[model samples]
Target: MMDIIDLKKKAAEIRIRLFQMIHNAKAGHTGGSLSNTDILTVLYYHTMRHNPQEPKWVERDRFIASKGHSVESLWCILADLGYFPKSELETFSQFGTRLIGHPNNKVPGIEMNTGALGHGLPISVGMALAGKRDHKDYRVFCLMGDGEQAEGSIWEAAMSASHYKLDNLVGIIDRNSLQISGNTENVMGLDPLDKKWEAFGWHVVSIDGNDIVSLMETFNSIPYTEGKPTLIIANTVKGKGVSFAENAIGWHHRVPSDEELALAIKELTEQIESLVSKEGQPHE
Candidate 1:
């Protein structure tokens, strides 16, 4: 396990990489990606058991980024984990690039091709059921957008997961208040989100999505129930780290101007520096 400080440093780096990739691509989903950075960092760098070299290793834990628009964060983390060269991150959303706007399974570390809203949970349920049937000990983690809860398929999948008693599965909702067009509540009310999942038989946990400590603690609490899946409703801001973008619906699919991108990068760099300095000593 990495020390908490080291993990935090990695999280900051992942955030910087996410901003750079999205800014460079000029056509990626920066808002959702930034909002989920800490969660993905915790999962890829610390919590989940995965083999970057053998992405399809059957015994490896599965992570499905259900809110596929958040692909930038996952792509950066995978590159940092050595699933692919970090240099390849430059091709994100470019013509002929495997790193499309949403995740594609062809990407070295991506487990599923997602981007279509509300598809990830059901697919993850299938994966979890397979693990149960085969008696595999591997766990499955699925990350969904808060707005995605509006989809009826998500509840359907939730019911199926409970019915199958998939204790090995974990669902994480990035409860960032804003979606593309407007606030999620105005677009489609999903208040009482936690209770809905709890009613569906999932063990629910809510946490501050951007706090690394809270994220680690929340993830560590998975598998809390013996016969049920766990659902973590992580309350978050839409564009998490960048001041200009945070919680602003305009950034949802908006391409940042050159000036905005430079500013965003600068802010992320400062965040990385702060975390690195607080680590007491540099990584060897």
Candidate 2:
């Protein structure tokens, strides 16, 4: 298990990588990607079981970035994990690059291609069902956007997963509050989200999505209920860790300018340095 400071340092590096990748692509989802960095960091570096060298290991855990626009963060983590060469990240969104704006299963570590809202949970349900039927211990993790809950299909998949008693499945909602057009609450309210999931028979946990400790604890506690899937409502800021982008809806799909990119990188570097310093000290 990585200490909190080490985990935070990894997250900062991921953020820096995310900024550089998107900036180089000149077109990518920055807001959503930044929002979910800490969660992805925890999953990849600490909580989840995965093999970078053999991505197809049947018993290895599966993670689907259901909100595919947030692929920037996932891409960087995949690169850091050695699933693909970091050099390939520079081709994100290029005309013929496999690293298009959304996730493509053709990409080495991606389990499924997803971009359209409400698609991931259903696919995850299928994966989880297969694992259960085959008696595989591998867990299926799906990350969805808060706005996606407005989709009826999400509820349908949730119902199906509950009925099947898929204890090995875990759904994480990146509750960042903003979507492409506007605030999720204004578009379609999903308040009392935890209650809603509980009513659907899921074991629900809520946490500060940007906190490494909270993220690790929530993710590690999966399958908490005896016969139910788990839902983690991760509250997050849309443009986390970037000064001008945080909580700013305009950055959702906007690529940062060179100046903005420099600033964001500097911030991330400072964060990484701080974490490194903390890591060097003895724990209290």
Candidate 3:
């Protein structure tokens, strides 16, 4: 297991890199990306069994970015992990770049092209079922946004995943409370979200999505019940790492200004330095 301090350091690095990408691209779903950075850091660095060198390795665990709009964080992680040249991140959202506003299969690590919302879970269910039918041990992880829960297709897919007893499937919701329009509850009430998934037959576990320790622990304990899929309701704050953006509805997809970018970078850098100092490691 990776040390908690190390994981926290990596997540802060990722946040800084992602914000730089967003700042350069001048477009991104800022809040959601920040909110989910820790969740993704744990999965890619600690929980998931994947190889950047052999992206299509049959035995590799699969990840589907269901809430695909907030893909900058994933992009930065993949680049850092050698999925692609780190220099390529500079092309994000540029014309003719594979790193578009949403997940694109053209990228090595992305399992599917998503951003339509409501499609990731359904596709993940199919993948999990396929893994079962083939007798493969590979697990399928699908990350979705809280706002996306309102889509009827999500419920249908939830029902199917449970009915099929796809224990290999793990569904994660970035429950940041805010969405593009406004607060999720104001747009479409989805309180008692965990209970709803439980009713659909998933084994629900709620945790602080921003806490890397919690994320590592939760993901390490997959298929909470043998015959059921696991649903992690990751309660997170939108724009998590940036002081000005944290929990702010306006930051959902808002690009950071030059000053905001500098400030965010400074804040995240301090966090990285703090962690490194405690660990007695020289800051790179």
Q: Which of the numbered candidates is closest to the native, going by highest lDDT?
A: 3
lDDT of 3 at 171: 96
Query: What are the lDDT figures for the candidates, one per model?
Result: 0.87, 0.91, 0.93
- TM-score for each prediction? 0.95, 0.97, 0.97
Q: Which ten residues in a row have the lowest lDDT in candidate 1?
A: 275-284
| CA RMSD (A), model 2 | 1.1
User: Lowest lDDT 10-mer window, candidate 3?
Assistant: 275-284
Off by over 4 Å in 1: 281-284
Across 1-284, the per-residue lDDT of candidate 3 in tens digits comes to: 46788889889998999998988988898999999999999999999999999999999999999999999999999999999999999999999999999999999988999999999999999999999999999999999999999999999999999999999999999999999999999999998898899999999999999988788889988978997999999999999988999999889888889999999999999998888778865522
Model 3, residue 105: what's the lDDT? 96
Pitting candidate 1 against candidate 2, the one with the higher lDDT is 2
In candidate 2 the C-alpha lDDT for residue 235 amounts to 94
